[model samples]
Target: MHLPGYPFESRWFTHDALRLHYLDEGDGAPVLMLHGNPSWSYLWRRLVLALRGEHRCIAPDHLGMGLSDKPAAGRHPFTLAARVDDLDALTGHLITERAAPENGWTLVMHDWGGPIGMAWAARHPGRVSRLVVLNTAAFPDPHGPRVRPALRLPLWLLRETRLGERLFLRHHAFARLATLPPFGLRDRLPPDVRAAFLAPDDGREHRLAVQRFVHDIPLGPGDPSWPLLVRAGETVAAFADRPVLIGWGLRDPVFDPLMLREWRRRLPHAQVHAFPGAGHYVLEDAHDSLVPAITAFLRR
Candidate 1:
C-alpha cells in the first residue's frame, strides 16, 4: 500500500486518562495487529490496506507512540505489564457487542508487541482464534549463550546509562536508524514513508516510549518483564496446535536465524515464509509475498 493512499480515518480509545490512537476498519472477523518500539500502528499501514476489505483490522498505537498521547515515565508505567493491560482494555472495549459469539481475533504481532500480545493471550486464550508471528519473539528464553550473552552488556548500557539516554532519547537512535538499511529495511523506505515512521517519535517527549521500550527488554531472570515473558511463551506454545503463520526476515540481526529455528522447533506445523533479502521490517521488504501468505492464512 502506498503512503499517499493510507486513507483510513484515525480512531481513539481512552484508557484511564490516556487516549490510544487506533484504526478500526472493514467488516468481517477481527484481525488485531500490534506493533513494536520506535514505530506505531503506521507499521501495519500496508497490511491494514490489504486486509481491511475482508477483515476487521484493528491496529492501535501504544500510549506513547503514534498519534496516541505521549507521556513521560512519571505519567505512566512503561513496562510490559502496562502494555498488556492497555491492549486488554482496548480490545475488551471493541469486542463488546461487536465480535461474533464464537470466533475470536487473529493476533498478529511484531517486536515488543509479541510479548505484550502473548501475555494478554495467555490470560484470554479464548479470545484468540489464530496466531501470526512476524520477525519478533514472545517466548521467555532470552537471546544468547556465548555471543548473545556478551552482546547483552552493550544493550544494557544502551538501556541504563546516560549514554543510552543521550543516544535514544536525545539523539533518537531508533527513529534515525530504523528507517535506514540493515536494522529497518534492506532497501530504504522512500523519504515520505520514512518520514511517516519517524514522525510519531519526532522529539524528546515522543522519544520516551522508544527509550523505555529499550530499557524494558528483559535480559535475565531478575528483569521485571521476565515472568511476563515466561507466561507469554506458554501461550506461544499453546497456539502451536492452532493455525500459526511465521513470516520471517532472514537478514534480521536481532530476531535472526537462531530465533526462527526456535520458533520452528516449537510450532513445527506453522506455515512459514522466510524472506532472504528482508531485514527487521519484513513487511516492507517482503510485502509482495508475505501479504498474500497472510491473507490466505486469515482466509483458511
Candidate 2:
C-alpha cells in the first residue's frame, strides 16, 4: 500500500520461499531498524527520513507483517526464532554477504523488535556499534511491580482462546483498537496512517501473522521461544559499554516503567528519554522531540 507521506523505495529478499520486504535507503553506515508485531517498518518512517541522508537505514517487515508476503502458518512458523532467523538471513542478503562494513550498524528496535534484534545482536555483538531501544524488551521479566493485572487477563484471553481469533482475525479488532486511544497515537491518528497500518492484514491469510504473534508471547519456561528470549536478554548486557539510547513512552501499559528500569539497570551508561503522556506508539506522539534527539545521538 502507498503510505501517504512515506514514499521510500521498497526492496525485497526471498526467505523460506516467501518475499520479505524492507526499506534500504541512502548510503553510508547502516542503521538497522526493527519493528514489533502488528507494526511494520512503517513505524520507523520518520526516523528513516531523518537518518537516510547520512546513513544506510534498513528496516525490514518481519515475514507476516508490513508489505512483506504473508504465507500460511504451515509454511512459516511465525515464532520468535523464525523471526530472528529471518533477520539473520536478511542481514546476510543485505550486509554480511555483500562485503558491507564489518561493524558500526546502529540497531534500532521497538516492541517485539527487542527480542528479534537482540537475538541478532547476540549472535554478532561485535558488529553492532550502537543501540536505539524504544519501548521494547529482549527478556521476559514477570516480577515487575508494574505488571498490571488489568491488562494481563485480556492478553491471556487473546493468546489462549478462540475469542482472540474472532476479535483479531474476523473483526480486525486489534488493528482497529491499535489506532485508538492507548495503543497508538494520542491524538486521532490520521485516517491515511491508520489505513496504511491496517491494509496489509485486511485478509484472513494476511491476519495469520498477527494472530500468531499474539500467541507467541513466551510467558514461561515451557514456551517455545523462551530459551531464545532468555539468551537474547542475557546478550543485551554484553553491549553495556556501547552507545545506547532508550526512548520510551511512560504511558505504555505493557512495557511500562519497570521495563525501562530493567533496561537502565542493564545498560547503565545508556541515555534515556521517557515521555509521560505518550503511549506504546511513542514515536507518533513525540516524534518532533524524539527524531531530533535521536538524530543528534546518531550524529554524535
Per-model TM values vs. the true structure: 0.94, 0.96
- Candidate 2 per-residue lDDT over residues 190-237, each given as its tens digit: 889888878888787788888888788887787899899899999988
Candidate 1 local accuracy as lDDT? 0.85
TM-score of 1: 0.94
In candidate 1 the C-alpha lDDT for residue 38 amounts to 74
Candidate 2, superposed: residue stretches over 4 Å from native: 96-99, 142-148
Candidates' RMSD to native? 2.1, 1.6
